[model samples]
Target chain A: MIEKKYRDLIDKLIQKSLMKKVSWNKSSRETEYYVHFKKGSFTVDNWVNDSSVYVDFTLRNANGIEIVSQTFEKESNPEEFNYLFKLYKAAEESYIKVDETISSIINELDEEDTVGKDEEDVLPF
Target chain B: MKRFRDPVFALIVYGIGLIIISFGYYFIPNDLKNIVNYISITGTFSSVYGILVAYAQIMSVRETAENTKLKIEKSNKRVMKILSVSDLSKAIKIIPEIQNYLSADKDESALMRLKDLKGILLNLKFIKDIEELTSDEKFVDALNELSIHSANLSKAMMGTKTGLNKSKIISDLDNIENQLNEFEGYLKYGNYD
Candidate 1:
């Protein structure tokens, strides 16, 4: 009986992964996520009839811009949930890395603008 | 009441009586020529008294007006100075790096310079706002250059954290200095006119 239950769990994990795929795009200063349905009808009626699971994610930049995205799949299982969680973490790390790189570039330019000036000379009038 | 009490009213009544007496003298027979001359002299004296009273009233009004004008000018100067000081305080808060970069001596010098500027602005003798300092063409040009410099500085500050390009910072400081120099020249020359 334990062997049968383990086989069932492995089958369910494979079924979930084959059912959904999450894809994302960055454009116009925003990021969007989409979940694709790999099986069954693509019509609205089919989507409405399907059992969907939702995943939530957040992205933040150094300049304090934050974006939250949510996507829904018709079916999800525990194994798929674990995989999605890992993907979400990786995305967040990439976003912060990009934000920090931009911030450093801007700071460098500011330091160059103040060279060779006597203390008496820096009033904005 | 005493005859000469209420000096203003007394003078008015005395002048009116003198006019009546002079008229009566004119109508009297030729025997009253000496009386007519004496009455005319009295009328002239009373009119001179009324003229003195009117002169005093005019002088009082002039003095009051002058005092009021001086007070208004002083109040205006005080209000303007307060506004300028408030603005300066805000500017300093927005740019706190100014305090970090200056040496102790330079900091004191900057403080004293600001104090002197405030004194001139508050001195009721100077009648213009600091913003008006840019009215001169040279000052305006310098101010525009300063704006560009500040923009550059902001961009540079936004760019790097470590190993910051000091040359860009120095250039921006130079721009700011040039603008301030122009402003000071105009101020020292009393260019408000």
Candidate 2:
């Protein structure tokens, strides 16, 4: 049984999922989820369907673009809700990780833009 | 008989006065009659002047009150507009949206989200009531800085999503947090620093 607090958390996450463009699906045959994020030099795609949960992303470097795809197949378990819960949790983690990485790039670039510049000269607004 | 109630008795005094005055043309010589005539004409003119002055004073006071009411109504309308939307709340809500796109390594989306924030800031700017609420200029400065950083962030990540400078990304993230914090602080509280 999901605790009331946990229920609230899931409901909140569900709302957030909607806002973040994460898709959730439940049909008679299968359940599915998807999250797509494109960040610096990388485009990440995560999918959780009936058969398996998979992550496919592209990484770009000097050599060339590298596409990485991994599928985590569903394993029989006593808990029916286990995979559903885990996929959502993983999506949340990935979402946060991707944000952190992009934030880093933006912050680093911001510093470069400000280096050796007088505070007064930055913006005349 | 004083003739307090009866019109006949009342007219008796006036008639007697009139008779005296009429006879006074002969009784009160020409010089005295001229003096009486001067006083009567002066009284008439004085009463008219007094009435006109009182009327003028009332009009002047009413005009001043009308002007004051108009100014107050204008100021109140401005205040109402500013309070219509919770600027602080709107600005605060945008932080997570920005962070979400950034985390997704989605600079494009992040930049777009910044546009939303920019709209919010611009809206705040349009309403002049903010000046009365807070005195610090840093609030506006912080908003402007966030806009620039957001734009630069998307532009830098535009062409090649693969060749991202890790160090640059790190610094950019820190910069974003700092600016966001500054803006949030200014909105939530009046603290500039």
Task: Assess each prediction's global lDDT (C-alpha) against the native.
Answer: 0.41, 0.47
Q: Measured with DockQ on alpha carbons, how good is candidate 2? A: 0.01
Deviation (Å) of A109 in candidate 1: 38
Instruction: Mark the 10 consecutive residues where model 1 chain A has the least summed lDDT.
Output: A39-48
- Interface RMSDs of the predictions, in order, are 21.9, 18.3
What DockQ results do all the predictions give, each relative to the true complex? 0.01, 0.01
Write one digit per residue (lDDT tens) for candidate 2, span B1-193.
Answer: 2222345554564456555555645665566667567567455655664565556556767777899999998778656543524665566566676666666777777777767765665565545555433223444433434433443355356531123333343343455445545544554565321
Candidate 2: Cα lDDT at B174: 52
What are the per-residue Cα lDDT tens digits for candidate 1 across A98-124? Answer: 555677777876785753557777775
Each candidate structure's TM-score, on Cα atoms with residue i matched to residue i, is: 0.31, 0.36
Q: Please report, as a residue range, the 10-residue window in candidate 2 chain B with the lowest summed lDDT.
A: B160-169
Lowest summed lDDT window (length 10), candidate 1 chain B: B160-169
lDDT digits (tens) for residues A1-125 of candidate 2:
34455446445545666465453321111122232222212223334444454433222321112333223333543242453355455455545566657788788778746535588888988
CAPRI-style quality class for the chain A–B interface of candidate 1: incorrect
